[model samples]
Target: MDPFADTLQRLREAFDSGCTRPAEFRAAQLKGLSRFLQENKQLLQEALAQDLHKATQLDSAFIRKEPFGLVLVIAPWNYPLNLSLEPLVGALAAGNCVVLKPSEVSKSTEKVLAKVLPRYLDQSCFAVVLGGPQETGQLLEHKFDYIFFTGSPRVGKIVMAAAAKHLTPVTLELGGKNPCYVDDNCDPQTVANRVAFFRYFNSGQTCVAPDYILCSPEMQARLLPALQSAITRFYGEDPQSSPDLGRIISEKNFQRLRGLLSCGHVAIGGQTDESDRYIAPTVLVGVQETEPVMQEEIFGPILPIMNVRSLDEAIEFIRRREKPLALYAFSNSSQVVKRVLAQTSSGGFCGNDGFMHMTVASLPFGGVGASGMGSYHGKFSFDTFSHHRACLLRRPGLEKVYALRYPPHTPRNLRVLLAAMETRSCSCALL
Candidate 1:
């Protein structure tokens, strides 16, 4: 009587029948996905407009990237299309049957994905589930081979707990309070421009966005004006009307962000309108470490600057908190940047800029400690979705050669076997 039972059973059967196991099959699925994007470009654009957002291998002694069957991809509402499809591509390319659960909060994009996406893929190997928490809870009750989730840490725990009952492997792409340190040696304008762009990108819903600033009070003084200039240049004086700036995703989110506006002195912009879910590209000064803005992941268009007397103080501040998803340090001195890098830990790090490290496909992206776990991107994506089953292929005629490893062993046999197995000879002066 479970609503998802039939679809789950069908995908399981499709995976078990070995229909998704071939490289040809996986390649075709990827091609189909590409086609879906290309053919329906306008449709996707319109859907996003409504929502207001959006390989390698080795020889016989190597790891095989084989799929984990029946993967569940739980994507968040922010940047819905990209987050949803990126994981989908990885799972499909790895030859797994996937069940994608797009966030219901992004109703417009979710509708398009649910109604249109299935037409592009093999129906037997893929499905799109639509619902809020209640239905998602029901769906997670059933088992899956792997789970990939992107969202807040609060809900990440729920996902992890559910995954545990089924003994499922997971990639929890959770968010944290990322920190950006600005050394006194840096150009205030250059640092300000980079930080503003990333902090307010996607209305600041980004998980890897620089959450707050740590700088000397002297640097904070100079940077405040520069940050204001950057905000003005980017979003204009009337930021609420700027087409480039995005609104908070929901009333709840807007209210949450509006509440944070009170945590620190409003230095640049602290405007809000519930009618449009608009929260202006804001900057806060005089923020304390104990404020809600400093304590939580500020997933909105607000930046708080906290004063640190020295580089050591800033590093100490960062170390005390839970490891962040991403960390940024801006300094004219390479040694200063290196010092920060060596002294701290984060899921990812970028020197002199925002979350640019994540833009490259070559780097693996995931969190450590409380931030999250597991990494995925480019070839890492293919690998993350795969189970590396160690395999060795030998000819039956080699049984005589392998007999040295068999039972009824002796010291002579052991010596011969050891000598034959060694890739290099051991040198002993005593010998």
Candidate 2:
């Protein structure tokens, strides 16, 4: 017998039963999820500490935010707790029956989620599956109403393929090589502080973290010392000993990041520890666009500097690559910042700073093009997990008024009907 057969059937039955359709029930489940988080704050934090080795940190309209039936949420290991709970919150609040598949790589947190999280919600409406890629692939063989995945582009493609088999809709939140542009008009020290803080946060494991720096050679020279100063102030001389610094999540990733250190001249820190899985807050200078460090999403504590002679050159360089998940520009001149914003395309953009734009709940978070598709955050999440079903109702006695829409084609009746159907002066306004 298939292991997932029973659970999938059960959740499908629960969704079909209409038990999860009520607004009050959905609100109650959301509250239960909140209570679970509030009550297990310490446990979840401990799980994050054990798994990640570091500290932690919508909407729609009158269209009716109805659930997409049974939802499948596949979360990544980097932000095990957040990536897991965030999509779960959205699915529940949207009134979907959910099956959460936590990353097997983050075993500690996975164990906690599987063992502890389900107790807080209706068992028939929710479940936590355990396993690695094999189990996930097997689970995907079955159909789901909606799927939300947070991971690499490669896996996102696989999830999309699987969803296509069932014509199921999906929301993929994938990572990319996010670029940060530092203009000649900026304060070197302030830019350095913000860039260094965000780039090295969680050992640079964040999906939206600035992956590399693009600037004039002169700005690079000035930023090197200022960035060194910020690093020392944040993590001290030996980042290895700093409690604030995080370790690579796995041995495989540690080896991969170690290999990236060889791509360019290590201007600052290049130290690594296999036993601790530590990669120091490092900076690379004189990196080329073709090198491995520049080609891929450097999801680690390694920041490479690439030279762009002017603002036009910088924009051209960014446009040449696939659209990134996030982009950043820093300059005293608002015109320079605005120019970058106007010229480029990305999932999100920040000016004169790092990823603070994501901290605001008003904004939707996800990627575009190669980064991935679909968005969710705040009300956006609710909308993403819901199906906007178009509905209309009319009085049974309105046959005479509705007759204009029926057959019998007369010129005057047609003109009147067309006029009534046309709600706006401009047809494009509906777009």
- In order of appearance, the predictions have TM-scores of 0.83, 0.84
Displacement of residue 205 (Cα, Å) in model 2 is 0.6
Q: List the residue pairs that clash in candidate 2.
A: 58-378, 58-379, 58-380, 58-381, 58-382, 59-379
lDDT digits (tens) for residues 1-431 of candidate 1: 79999999999678645588678999999999989977996798679858964300111344577899999999999989999998888999999999999999999999999999999999999999999999989989999999999998988999999999989999999999999999999999999999999999999999999999999989998998999999999989999999999988898888888999999789988878889999888899988889999889999999999999999899989988999999999999999999888878899999998988988999999999889999998888999999998764444464565676666666676567656644443321110
Clashing pairs in 1: none
Listing every candidate in turn, what is its Cα RMSD in Å to the true structure after a full C-alpha superposition?
A: 18.7, 18.8
